[model samples]
Target: MNFLYEKITFIFDPLHHFWEHEKLSRKISIMLVLFFVLSLLAIEAKRLGILTGPLFSFVPTNHFYAISAAFTVVLILEVISLVFTLPCSFSRSVGKQFEILSLILLRNAFKELSKFPEPLTFHGNQEAVLRILSDGFGALLVFGLLGCYYLVQTKAAEKAMRPTDLYAFVAAKKGIALTLLGIFIYMGLHSLTATLAGREHTDFLHQFYTVLILTDILLVLISQCFQPSFYAVFRNSGFALSTLIIRIALAAPPYYNVLLGLAAAIFAILLTLTSSRLFGKK
Candidate 1:
């Protein structure tokens, strides 16, 4: 167990250290933005023959592509934020995941827009129109639901614990965060290598959520050590359900994905509100 603990810490130390520095975090954010902008410019230039071939040729030249890229970066940052926030508040961390999923749906909607027929008419391309309508409206609905979640979440009070128990809980959560960071790094490298090798990449979102479900179950077990109330367990378990919904969404068609994902968020919010009223009333 000691060796395993040290290995986990070693894998996650950089992420742990990165969040400790506000300046470093800001610098990294700026660098990601700059990289995205430069990449878009490079891709556009290559498409126009101002740059050489074999660079981002797999990517198409479209404004939607830029939007997708930017959102992809945001999704990665949000996942990191979720890991950091989990140690502090599990509900809030789950909310961050909902936010990430909403952005992903929005990103896919933009991609659908890019496929719109030239001259853009409702005639003869009804399928594309329906896709855009479904994705766009679905994203809007999810975003609205997310706002409701925030309001409900604000009403949920934090559970008090003995200082020693709180310390142990936080430490355990941090260890889980480190493990997630390791998974993120490994998935990224796996995706990059697969892309370079001209092979189909793994569904990273699915994999991440699978790990997350197990992590949340572990967290629930750990919370038992602190003599958590019934509501605490229910809320944590609800979060696991939310993560499972997201994993399922990844394999679903766009329209169904949006509906299922939105339902999951709503369910989670309802659970939180119920827990607050029944057990967290002050």
Candidate 2:
């Protein structure tokens, strides 16, 4: 228990102690949410086709764009997303990561039961994962750029660029590291699901989940620029506003298209609130 406690503390220590209670509270709240969502997923596992249709359409599976054009679009999206999202505290920053991960995990489980009703084809899953990796790299780039931008923006950051700013510099570095760890965990989980489950032979769970994750990465990137501004609004009594936007964007007429919508609105709201506080005051 002591070892586990140390591990947990270390994972969270990068965040300030002022945020300790908030993080623990959020962890519990998210756990409850995980339970409810997994329950829904277990039920939806019986109806797979509807679930996978959305994921397939979300990814340009055929690879139509030129490599350069494709790369540019991804780069732009990541930069825009991170430009808006990076300012919210580390714990707040990762909310969208949880949201997207939750959605993909559930969606993939459903895809497993429906699409490959016959034999498992796990290698097929790699296609979606590959696209997500491409996007994730774009996200890493954006986060990298934003970290530098924020470092320069900080008073301590701008003061000297000295050895002592090293603490703040390290804080920014930890943020980047945490974000990367999330991506690695996502990939590892995707692979593990296919390999450990009998579906390893026939499952495309990895593929669909990967594509969805790219969208998740984008959402988090966007939060970097605006999370603070938006949260101020939320705490001021904008209860349903954020949820409404997310729901509207996610409601893909026929189904929610991962790449085409605001799949992670909560982060957007907090991000917007945070950015406004910093940049919009009178």
Candidate 3:
């Protein structure tokens, strides 16, 4: 177990460093801008009969689709960031999940925009407009609630019986985080292959959220091995439940998706507040 843990750490550290590098982030930002502009140009070209292929079939010829594509890429980056957060404290990881949830809601709002005509008239797009409002405001509400959640968060780490125990706990979480990163890359490649093959690809983020639900449970169990206090268990388990609710929110329809997301956020905030007040050391 110790050897495996060391190997996982050895591999994860450099990958994590590369991901967090300033140069890579700048390049990714530049690539995203280029992708957005190229998407718009591609769509216009297809519309004007300048581009033709089966690959272009799925690409909608709408200015708003470019925006949606850009948002989707941004959301993908956020999810990757969330994966890295798993090695942190459970509370911090949960906070990262909430951040991704808000971005997903915002992406949904922009996705609805793709349904509108190029000129973007409001006349026939009432339902789409309503969806946009629902998802947009839902994101804002979660964003605001996330602030409150963080405000109530205590910065102190949970105590272990020994320093070595704390070190082992972190090592275990790093292993789990590395495993999740592998699964993430596999799922991403699988989804991309399906899309390219003209197969019906699943919603990549939604599928990953299902995996994340199981991962949260695993995290709770692993955490118990090091910190078995009632308060610690309850807090971590409650956060797992919050993640489950977020998974459901992702699967829900538009208006109700927003509602469920808000419910999940409120539940998390309440859980944090209650746990802190009741469990804090005097």
Candidate 4:
């Protein structure tokens, strides 16, 4: 077990540090700007028939799609960040998920922009505008609620575990997180390939959330090994259920999606408060 823990740590620690580095974030920000500008120019070129051939085939010819593309890249970065949060306390990890959920909502709002005409006429844009409103406000609501979730969090439950058991639980989660990173890469590459092969839409994020649900369930079960107490198990399981709701929200239609996301966030907040109240006193 020690050997396995060391191996996982050796792989995860450096990668996490590099991923969290300020330099990398700056580089990615610059790249996102370049990507957005290049995408707009390329899209305009495609629209004007100046760019030809299969390389540009998958690229949409709308300038608004550039915004969507930028948001997609941002969402990908957020999901990568989410994967690194897996080794933390369940509540903290779930909080991170809520963060991503808000971003996803914002992304959906940007995606709705693609439906607008180039000159941005209001005619026939009512439904699209309403969808945008739903997504934008939904994102804001989730973002605000996330602050509450963090504010109510206490370390008492986590501190209740024995040191050795806590160590084992953390190591186990680290291994799982490392494995999740691998799966994330594979899914991303697969999605890209499928898109390049002319698949109109690949629901890559949705597929990944499905995998996350399974991972959350595994995490809940793994917590049983080190902290078999009722409160601990129930709390972890409730977090997992919250993740499942988030997954469902990804598939739901616009208004329904917003409602589900809010529901998930509220459920998580209530769960945290209940667990903290029940077990934190001891």
Q: Which stretches of candidate 2 lie over 4 Å from their true place?
A: 1-98, 105-113, 120-231, 234-240, 248-255, 263-274, 277-282
Highest lDDT among the candidates is held by which one? 4
lDDT per model, in order? 0.75, 0.39, 0.86, 0.89
The RMSD of every model to the true structure, in order and in angstroms, is 3.5, 16.2, 1.5, 1.3
lDDT of 2 by residue, 6-84 (tens): 4544664654343335776577557655654554553354345444443233222211222222332233233323322
Instruction: In model 1, state the lDDT of residue 57.
Output: 49
Q: Distance from true position, residue 160, model 2, in Å? A: 25
Which whole-number lDDT from 0 to 100 does residue 108 have in model 3? Answer: 91
TM-score list, all predictions: 0.82, 0.25, 0.95, 0.97
State the lDDT of candidate 3 residue by residue for 104-208, as single tens digits.
Answer: 999999998878886879999999999999999999999999998888886433544687776677778888888888898899999888877788977888899
Predicted candidate 4 versus true structure: per-residue lDDT over 73-103, tens digit per residue: 9889998998998988888889888998999
Model 4 whole-model lDDT (C-alpha atoms): 0.89
Question: Could you give the candidate ranking by lDDT, starting with the highest?
Answer: 4, 3, 1, 2
True-structure lDDT of candidate 3? 0.86
Evaluated against the true structure, the overall lDDT of model 2 is 0.39
